[model samples]
Target: MSILIDSAVVLKSYNNNIVSVTINEEERILFAKGIGFGKKFGDKIEKGTEVEKIFILEDEDNLRNFKQVIENVDENFLILCETMISYIENELKEDLDERIHVALVDHLNFAVQRLSNNEEIENPFLMEIKALYEKEYTLAEKVAETLQYEKGVNIPVGEIGFIALHIHSARNCGKLSNTLKSTHLINSIVEYVEKQIEVQIDKTSLDYARFVTHLRFAIKRILSDISIKNDFIKEIKSKYKLSYKIASGVSKILIEQLQKNVTVDEIAYLAMHIERLRIATIDK
Candidate 1:
């Protein structure tokens, strides 16, 4: 099968001779390898330039194959897939618009991959990526809570569903880091807080995941503090008396080093300190 480039494309980068080509329309990137000679001079393929190459794929199959590759390469592909499902659910019609879904997913994936350097993904080296995604998910939940408390705005459930998708995919990958696993535990506590507060926090803002990540790291530091100093648990429990059970669970696990003398007051302080630090650092 032969594929045609419909416009001037930038050589975003090259790996082992395979060029990552970018154009405006179709997000199905061109992976032309070893085309040889002058093509490497980076001539202006121009906005209207067209080149044909032979490959073992037709149009539809090529799109599907590229998407599958993306899914394997970037776990975040599930987020895109879920977004389309959400669209289908919200649509009033019985039959969902498949074409629109495909185009949107491809475009969104292409944009995010470049921003996140997601295309640089390694096949057998996905462990770090899985940890990164989970860390981001757990933190997103916390930031959502912080926003709701500070701004009186509730985070949308769709975004939480998306974050949940990331968490599930990361857990399924089974390569989370110790820090990410700790964040998972903290996420459960934050989720309980969200329920107690009776409010939803939206994470639709740009860079929301990044904000969550910072909070997670900051909160992790607090956990380290609790482990090092025995009094953190008692403080937190006293502060969030209504959330004492949830706070206590976090204290018991995080401050296991303290042993036997953990108190609600220390745990309450730990939560309060973490929230204060998170607000001081994360962007609004």
Candidate 2:
């Protein structure tokens, strides 16, 4: 019942517990306690040997994370980690970043252990996670359900949000550490503007789509220390006072949540987009 295909030759031993292997001439790192014990360079890993896990490190970052996991976690945990990842990849038909092998595995191992010990943690961003990441949340629920059925562990509902976060991070190449915060910030700003203008936004509208796109990049820029300068900041502030005021409120939320300063140019641009969206909503 071994699921592995394509026999691989051991290339090098990272340690007594981990080995680098090449399958079909393509290199991958394998982790199995005692798999590398007494194994030498260029040794062909025996077929049907139970490897705790194998990782295809596509880049240096992935390799680093894989090494960290191998160094820190036990072999049994890695097995569960690999199984969950394989299930998700096969079910979703998406290639997640290799980092999920480390992050999600670590989270689930700890979460399951804690729940077994009658300790539970609450997810503060659960509502936003459910709202913004519906697909990932659904997948997370299925993951929880599978674990409960197979492992006899009843993972808490709150863990679904945390799992959804990991799924989202993996799907987006691990750039969504603050995704829930970013989502909440965007929704709050949109809601604030809509209430101020006494209009409900059409989420299906192109203008709303454009506004969301703008906010998404704006959040990225703030996180990445990138800023834009608007030469007409004064003009924009004067011309769109109502929009500017709403944007200022959003700027405050960004500052509070991200602890990053938002430039007047960023505020002005947000205001301009908000004004456009407001106008569009009114016309509709």
True-structure RMSD, every candidate:
18.3, 15.7
| Candidate 2 lDDT by residue in tens digits, 1-284 | 24356667887776766788888877788766687887787788766777766777775644655566566666655666677778788878978866577667766777888988889876645776788779889989988987788668888878987788788767875345565666678888788878888999886444564576567667866775664656778998999999899899889988887899998888998999988988888787
Output the worst ten-in-a-row residue range by lDDT, candidate 1.
120-129
For model 2 the local lDDT of residue 135 reads 87
Candidate 1 lDDT, tens digit per residue, 146-236? 4356435455433433333333332332334753565576566446545644444333322223333333433433533322233445555
The clash count of every prediction, one per candidate, is: 24, 0
Candidate 1 off by > 4 Å: 1-174, 177-186, 204-246, 249-269, 273-284
- Any idea how many clashes model 2 has? 0
Best by TM-score: 2
Instruction: Flag regions of model 2 displaced more than 4 Å.
Output: 1-18, 22-27, 31-38, 46-54, 174-284
Instruction: Point out the worst 10-residue segment of candidate 2 by lDDT.
Output: 173-182
* Cα TM-score of candidate 1: 0.26
